[model samples]
Target: MVASIKSAGKLSESSIRSQDDLEKVVEQEQPKKKWRWRVDTSDAPKEIFNRTLYLSILVFGVLGSARGYDEGNISGTLAQVSFKKTFGLSDPHKSKDEVANLKSNIAAMVQLGSIGGSLLAMYTVDRLGRIRALQQVCIIWIIAAIIQITSKNVGQLYAGRLIEGFAIGQTTTIGPLYTAEVAPPQIRGMCGCIFAGAVYFGIMMGYFANYGTALHMLNTSQVQWIAPTSIKIVLAGLIFIGSFLLCVESPRWLVKVGKVELAAQNLSKIRHLPPDHPYIVGEVADINELIAIEQEAISGSGVFDKIREILTVKSVRYRFFAVATMSQLLGQWSGANAVTIYSPELMGFAGYKGVERLKMTAVLGVVKFISAYASAFFIIDFLGRRKALYTGITLQMISILFFAIFVTVVPNATEDVPLPLTASEDRAAKAALASLYLSGVGWTMGFNSIQYLLGSEIFPLRIRSFAQSAIMVLHFANQYGNSKALPKMLLSMHKFGAFYFFVGIMAISLFWAWFFVPEVAGRSLESMEDIFSLPWYMIGRKGAELCPDHSEVSKIHVNSSGHGNAYDGKLDYDEKTSVHHDEGNSLMVKDSNEKDLEKEVKK
Candidate 1:
């Protein structure tokens, strides 16, 4: 199969000009007695998995670790009496209002930086290239880390947090995007999971460092602030440098931007594929198909025209909506940032004070990271995207319900508001905090990792980065909303009110997933042409026969002639056939040219 695909390389000049004509002629022949699926790296040498793919995926994980360090370390560092004093947050017990306002400002402001970074990422990701984008974000993280380390007051800390947020947004957006484009399709989901797991690892590390740093403060004065956590700044800076030197560029991006030779070169370097390796050939073919699609779209010019082009593609438009909404909503619903940035105090409200609450936060981060790993390994193959998310979202909604029940109904049942500190009451407070941690566990496993992975997968190359960035920005916006709103809502309307709101949102999102989001498990980007043809009703409900059988191929060509020379196995504007397919059967295949033309116009 690989040999046949390789032999069918490079359309000739005459053949190229009359692709439509050639397709028509090719269609008349009863399809050969062969499978109709495209080739991915499934049968490539085990060496394909040797060092390069694993190392690259792992390096992507390191990116997550660096991110995790920053995410986790802040909570611990913020707990130190001296560290809080440096930011004028000392005596938080007496100045709770002032400290709370400042903390809120920090949380809200980081998202503002994320807004800028997210917008920048959308514009520069494709322009600067994925590796370069990641490198730049790394630089930002290092700078922000340094700024944070030297901060003198709440204002400087705010600046540093915002800067860090920007870097985080870009890293989150590009890291997974790069992983998806570069990793072997067989392990793509796993690679994505590695990145997510790395993040959790970082979060756990941050918590560990923070706990160690504040644990009895036994270190010398010069190293007091420089104990376990002081190394975090160095670790972050090192990750930035390492990724810049080590991470490979996405060959697909290189191909899309007309750097075919460079794309081929990068593909070889990253895969460690010898010249003429089957993987390289399959990759090149895949690249060529995407390039052709983009070229067709590029016939339009001018910035506005290009922007108009993006808005026109049905896939792009829908992806943009779904990704953006998911980015925002998932972060919020997962209750991660809310818990990480504010829950220390919230837990304090329930009486788990000092390093205890901080440790719990770290535990939650670990749960998130580990679960992401689980999702990465099993999501693509064992459970399709829909089932994983269905399970995940359902779990999160249930957890949030129980949490709200604890907050509103259970607390009332105890009749324990303002209760005296009996051992029984202390036990109850501890139980409540434990429940919140459990809620964090459920939300992180499903919503956090799946949303990032799915958002990156759903769009085509022509505008994937742009679409992803927009979605990520919206994710930050959602995070910001949750962070800001939850605290205020908790004060104003009580905890259950906030949880109930998330419950409603997650319920709607679950419905959206059941009905709208398609399952892309175990399928390559090219295979997505099948997904394009699927009706909304069939999405996530059943799998489509993406690769036609030899018999179906014969039928396709037999009924396909003179139906407009455009059908290259993609759907088109002719809605009568594509939209109204019979039940238990998928939508019709379409012409490559017509689909590209239509996608370009739609964008």
Candidate 2:
């Protein structure tokens, strides 16, 4: 749209040109928009990130997928190589206890490393920028890969797994945070799931890589070990280089570290703001406001006082508890990781032998990848976070229950269960495999993806890193519990009983999530402070709303029927006037300080 120029009767052509030039100059100094827009501070959705932000998030997601691939690939592909032989478990006739112990140790080692990495992440993620720390972890992953590839003993190999697991822990925490922080509100939910989806994709890649390698007999040769695992190494190297070169470091992190100028510059670049764009101005203002809050929170405080402040903040406390507890519960009870880390062994127990087990794992990986992609696109938005989680968890619980019942009833009735060579075959073994595949699909849709997304959402800016790290630790603890005990439990109680244990845990998780887990689907990450201050019921209810038109202040009415009504409005807080009028001329309050009192009334 062109600005209309009005010429008075005495206007000169030179003056008109001069006026036009001044208008151009003013326009250049402002953010160009198709139309004038105003964002209401109270309910505005987060500013949509620009091309740079999307690129950075995508890069991080790719690296995250690679990291996830490394975590699960070793489980399914170990059967083909001297991984068993190299680990001194070549004979199937070995004592069951010995084999169980060794596998447990390998699985347990990853959890151990995760524990360490998580603990370290809690402290360092804030100090080091998210991109910088992830870059450093890429180096750590490479070293771990080198150790695993060069190992002569099981101990060395396990050590490598531990180190890699540690790296993954850091990756898990930072990758989601990076994506969440960078994403535009329109796509933030999808962006948050990108890592989980990527991981599933990576799992598929790892499975295919291993399956093909096994078919080609690559891992049998020393040179092939380097090639197969080298895929990750090359990916890791690319991630490190890409992060430093192409990735945009978080503007939030820059602001936190007192780099205001750098933060503003980065924000402008990430938001595609012209030098004097309005978005740049708004971002700078937001940054300053946050910094001011941070200063006020920590001012004149010692270390203990600072800690007290964080703990005392309702937002921080609720998020920390919600994320940590949910992670631990889901991690232990979901049974997806259990199936992933021990799929080969579980398939063996179900009577699959030789390469068939590995192929089945590849199939499982494919199902997981496909389902995760579907969920990434559809579930988080259409179903809302809480409902999607509820549905997914319920389905997962049913799948596990079916598995348990089948093992207890059907498998016991037949002396030999007929196995199908193809997915089309209607054999009992194929049916069981199908059940396992469905179990993975349920998990990808619900627990695994939801946990990461929820963990990122619950925390506010001040303790986002700390809260996520705490949850990660709890998550691994649950993983560790399963790795250390599930095998032994299966040995003593049978496969049916082992699955029953997970079912029981899943039932509890479902209940906890239903009752306690707050919905955070469309809420801006910054609005977490507002969410936490609400009652539990309201928190999840609002979380279910679509976008909430956050670009303006929302005036909400307390309904007599208990379902509230909301509209866009300005909350006028005039200290001089005894009464404050909402945008609709509604008497929002009779006193300016009544706004503070109204919070208590709402509670």
Candidate 3:
């Protein structure tokens, strides 16, 4: 089944001038056949799993690790007495209430800056290219790390944190997008999922570094506390080096910009295929064809026009934006960040304190990172995105609800009250702690990974970077809100009220995902517009579509046997066989007049 669409732009502009073109445009469909299901990679050559592919995916993990280091390191920093005293956050002169407010500002400000970075990425990623975008963010991280290492006051620390956050937003935005674009269709989910896992890997790195730092510098010299901040420099430096040395620009972006020859070469280099290799040739042709239609639809003349095109067009609006935005919304409301960034303090409220609380925060970081790796390497491909998320969101909502209840009923539970050391209180705290970590399993495994994967898969070449940037910006906005709201809410509201609030939000998100999110696991990126052209309800349920038997092929007469004039087998993929078959299902016009039109244009 050829799933690639016709030259939609030409078909549209010249429809009235040619009858033969109209015949060529007729779409042929066979009745649904009983085809068996196999993985999409069956069509991919075994060379798909070679070193270049692994290195490419692992490098993005490097990007994620840098992000996680910043995100996870701070939780451990807060546990250090030296860190607090030097910053005046836990100064003797300050009231507990005052200190809490300061902590909230310092922690939440990072996310506020990330929202700005996400917004900026919308234009810069589309313009600068993915590799350059990553290089620029790496420099930002390096600068921020230096500021953090040299900081004396919370104000300076906040500045560094905000800069780091801004840089992180862009890395996370581009990491998965790049992953999805480069990976073979069969393993795309696994490769893309690694981006989230790498983030957790960074978190683990940050937390362990902080843990080590706290052991040595808990109450020592102010300069000693800078150890963990200094670590970001190393991780970001590695990414800076890798950005230039390890990666090629996304071929899809190259085609969108009219560099088709370069795009083909890059595709060959990345896929380890000869330029004329069927997959490479077919893909390059499809990219050119789809890009033409996308260019026709979305004008890059100005930012406003691109924005209007996405919002105004139904296929772009419902399939890409709506699904991407909702998934991001869940990422924010999943309640993972509350635990990841603020776990030490959050655990303190559950009666664990001092070094023990810090250790427990590291443990949660371990759980999160483990979940991320587990999902990245294994669960995502087998279970697919929808089931993983359904399982994840449902479990998380249950855990949060239980956590809220347990914390609320603990003896004399009150806003900003530290958990006491009594036996009964300790038991209650332990139970709440169990629920929290249990939810981490779901959060990291499902919400964290799938959101990034979905955002990367949904957009077209013409506007992918821009659309992804918008989605990331919106994602950070929610993260910023949660960052701002959680610190205070945990202190100001009923001890359990925040969890209950999260319960309501996650409950709504689960339902939204069930009805709206479609399965895109093995589908080619060039075929997304075709996927959305059909009714939304039919998207996932219609498995690999089968092409008509070879018997049906001989009767048809073809005009131009061009590369772009083919259907992507994904829409009509036969599940019984793993191969991706292209049926030349393009809209071709048959006329000397049309042919002469092309000739005259060339003259």
Off by over 4 Å in 3: 1-40, 299-301, 412-428, 535-603
Query: Which of candidates 2 and 3 reaches a greater TM-score?
Result: 3
User: On a 0 to 1 TM-score scale, where does candidate 3 land against the true structure?
Assistant: 0.82
Best candidate (score: lDDT):
3
Estimate the overall C-alpha local distance difference test score of candidate 3: 0.70
In order of lDDT, best first, we have: 3, 2, 1
Task: Give the best candidate by TM-score.
Answer: 3
Q: Write the per-residue lDDT of candidate 1 for residues 1-603, one digit (tens) a residue.
A: 211111223223433334454444444422344542322332334455666657666666667665566656665665667765666656636464566566566657767787788888876788898767777777777788777667667678788878888887787778788888887655666677677777777878777776666666643332444454456566666766766667777888887777777777788888786534434555565557555766776775444654675577665555555544654565466555666666556566555556786767667666676666666665544565667767877776776666666667444322314345467656766666666666655555566666667767767777667767777777777767776676677666665677687778788877777766666765566555456545545644553444331211111111222232212321112222222212222332332444343332223
lDDT of each: 0.61, 0.66, 0.70
Q: Write the per-residue lDDT of candidate 3 for residues 397-448, one digit (tens) a residue.
A: 8988888887777735333465355787778778888888888888977788
Sort by TM-score, best first: 3, 2, 1
Model 1 scores what on Cα lDDT?
Answer: 0.61
